[model samples]
Target: MLGIDCPKPKGRWPTAPFDPRFPKQNQTRNCYQNLLDYRPCVKRMRRRGKSTQPCEYYFRVFHALCPMSWVQRWTEIKDGTFAGKI
Candidate 1:
């Protein structure tokens, strides 16, 4: 379930949780954790003038970090809600 070969779903994936301890770094860290490295995507989103909601960035980060298979399985897990995932 933690590997890179999981099957991702077709629809949009859910968002990852935010880290409370590091509020300032939460967006960057969470996005990195989810998308592996979303600096470019974040920049693109910013260029596109998208709303800078944490959840939106988090979802993009998730798409970047997770494999296609894992994205599919994520819907089944239902464990990574706003409350917590790890």
Candidate 2:
């Protein structure tokens, strides 16, 4: 048993918590919505001179659920091409 005898790490990885709004098994829509929500939350907080720390929740959720490629693509095109309101 290769490495089976080794002790496992003691840390838990962070992931998105259950959202009642997205109760379905397929999380594609959840991922997209979180991505959309994160931007506006950050923008609004910045505009109001409030701390953006709370917006990290949405960022973490979308980061965990969305594919890196999709995130990268959206980041590249979000200035003009992204349809979701930020």
lDDT of 1 by residue, 1-86 (tens): 32223233457755555566447733544544554333334445567888434434555546654565855555444433422323
Q: Model 1, residue 31: what's the lDDT?
A: 41
* Backbone clash tally (model 2): 0
Candidate 2 per-residue C-alpha lDDT over 10-71 given as tens digits, one digit per residue, 9 for 90 to 100: 45648889999989999999999998888888778878999877887787788789998987
Which pairs of residues clash in candidate 2, taking residues 3 or more apart in a chain or in different chains? none
- Score residue 41 of candidate 2 by CA lDDT: 81
Off by over 4 Å in 1: 1-53, 78-86
Least accurate stretch of 10 residues (summed lDDT) in model 2? 1-10
In terms of TM-score, the best-performing candidate is 2
For all predicted structures, in order, the TM-scores are 0.31, 0.79
RMSD after CA superposition, every candidate? 12.1, 11.0
